[model samples]
Target: MTATAIVLLVATALSSLVPVIVRRRLRSTLVVDAVTTAVMVGFAATAAALAADAAPARGVGVVVVACAAMIAAVGGGGYVVRLVLWAGGADTRERARDSATGDGEHVPDAESESGTEAEAGPLRGGRVIGYLERAAVAATLLAGWPEGLAVILAVKSLARYPELRAPHAGEQFIMGTFASVLWATAMAGVGFLITH
Candidate 1:
């Protein structure tokens, strides 16, 4: 790998990791969101600066950069989705937990604060779903099988169909899923860039 590729790879890795560290270190969603935005911008600037270097990474450098891109796809989507949700005024907070069940499931509804597994709460478990969705999307793209995106979308839409009827659920689902898939595909593109 050229020095530019190394720098770009490092930038990609930072993009993948900095938000997670900032989110854990800071309590302010605003600040963490700001950092996420900044990291993305920084990554773009770094990539642009080195974009002229069309030399693909070789051997271990390819593996390392690809891994960084995968991490960005899987882990970075949370920040992207969170930022979108926050900007759109969606309630990004997890629903109130049920004390009775000892599980972390959301409080079901007005009728039941105790939260049975059957009830669909707003944006419940969305974080994990987003992560998994992005992971799958990233993996498929990185594997050179773009058709996996259709399967991923179909599965998610079908699975989320029941909960889509709830208030704000459809909006959140669409926004989050769009942000997530975009982020994953973009990161996968970044990974591809490392090869060319």
Candidate 2:
């Protein structure tokens, strides 16, 4: 049992680390997202399963799992955010627009769609912000300073105040932020379990 536990813990850390190296250049968008998301879920479940290990990680093991925890926070968190957005039907309208615009098919835009000019385009820098956000969240939780999470979140919201006012941006912002923060917290919990 002791050997099994150690092996599992090591495996968990390595599994989490390996997927980060996956080239996200897959041919299909759906396939790329699905694969990454699958790996993310696998890491989470693996970490959770190893929560009851007989011994906490020591030496370099702690570092490895700590890195893995961050991996889970960023990648898994993204997938969760995507799921929440999809469930909320937040982008459905944009996605379902006239597919017939190309080729021989012709479908005119409705009046509402025609006159609509984006005030400043969709929120830019979201991907970069998400990475920084996840890193900050995971680091704070791992450092045993949970209060830093609140500060980080407050800063993010305040910085994006103008963009958040855009249509659907509020929903996207809230759901994405919540998902990342929550995912980071959970993965940090797993990191804490193994590292401490």
Judging by TM-score against the true structure, name the best candidate. 1
Number of the top candidate by lDDT? 1
Evaluated against the true structure, the overall lDDT of model 2 is: 0.63
TM-score of each: 0.78, 0.71
lDDT of 2 by residue, 106-160 (tens): 2332433575433222466665687789889999998889899889989998999
Cα displacement (Å) at residue 13, model 2: 7.5
Clashes, model 1: 0
Clashes of 2: 0
Q: What's the CA error at residue 21 for candidate 2, in Å?
A: 8.6
Candidate RMSDs in Å, in order, are 6.6, 7.1
